[model samples]
Target: MYVKFRKSSRVFLITVLFGMLMILSASAQTGAPINVRGSITDVAGEPLIGVNILLQGTSTGTVTDYDGNFELRVPADGVLEVSYIGYKPQTIPVNNRTSVLIVMQEDTEMLEELVVIGYGTVRKDDATGS
Candidate 1:
């Protein structure tokens, strides 16, 4: 009985195993969902109510609690978009983080073009050209 166990063959087997491990590790890192918790507040330091928290570039999202706290599952590299009425939308990257604190800023650019000609108010889209 004879067995052939060359050193070169052993090294090749080790290298293959190492390569497979690296590939699997990298694959597990990509698009992995992680649990993230955060709080949303206004610039005035008040907890924002019913804030819309969504993962950027995706439809997955949730709403903040009445206390402005929220928890969601997001990709390790995903970005979050937080939005609320009368507030500017904010985007934040996960970057493998587990917790976040967000302060929402108010938006003042909304223009309700109301034209008053003594009694009726005409919106920009309702005006007619004669």
Candidate 2:
């Protein structure tokens, strides 16, 4: 008795092999997530809670817990931006930083708002002239 694979069977087998090869190649080129751990604190050296920590240009983010500790997994070699409501925003390179401690200073200068009145928008500083 002799057994042989039909043409369609051979084509299906080849297609499956090609798909698996592509999947494996793609996965091998992908990098793993880098672990990031940090603590947020105020200028006075006190731990600041509820501080917002975000990776710049991405939606990945986390908030400091009550102990002012935050841990997140970001793609390797990404940039991170840290900010809080009353504190100045800071941007840091995350290339080799696995653990970090950041002190955020309060922003004393308030941002003036611009409003649109009638036909055009006016800056808060120039609103009186318009």
Candidate 3:
């Protein structure tokens, strides 16, 4: 009976080891998260400050610095969504690259209209020269 119990315990240990190996291999195949850095610019090659850079389908995001540069951690195969006021939004794929540069086009339709609000008032004493 003692010999039989030892054999069964060994088999159980081997099964546990096999399961752990399988889990590790699966995680490796799916790939790990990576850090991505990049810059945003307009069509004229001017840096776009405060541009939005978001991980597609997720709330994870960052904004460009004063020089239009940004950095964020994302999945190995992830997409970036970029947007700014008066500019057409863009979708970019990281493709496992650590760095990238994006150029945005202007959205003339959105910038075509403008609105201004003000209130004008005149003092009666000043107007009448009292």
Tell me each candidate's TM-score: 0.66, 0.61, 0.74
Top-lDDT structure, candidate number: 3
If the candidates were sorted by their TM-score against the true structure, best first, what order would they fall in? 3, 1, 2
1 against 2, candidate with superior TM-score: 1
lDDT tens readout by residue for model 3, 1-130: 9999999999999999999999999988755789999999999999999999999999999999999999999888889999997799999998899999999999986655432224433433333332
Ordered from best to worst lDDT, the candidate numbers read 3, 1, 2
lDDT of 2 by residue, 1-130 (tens): 1235577788899999999999999865554578999999998889999988898898989999998999988766677899876578999777757898999988855334555579876666777852
Model 1: per-residue Cα lDDT over 1-130, one tens digit each: 1235577778889999999999999988777889999999998999998999989887999999989999999989999998886678888999999999999888755334544456666775787777
- Please give the TM-score that candidate 3 achieves against the real structure: 0.74
Q: Candidate 3, clashing residue pairs?
A: none
lDDT of each: 0.86, 0.81, 0.87
Instruction: Point out the higher-scoring one by lDDT: 2 or 3.
Output: 3
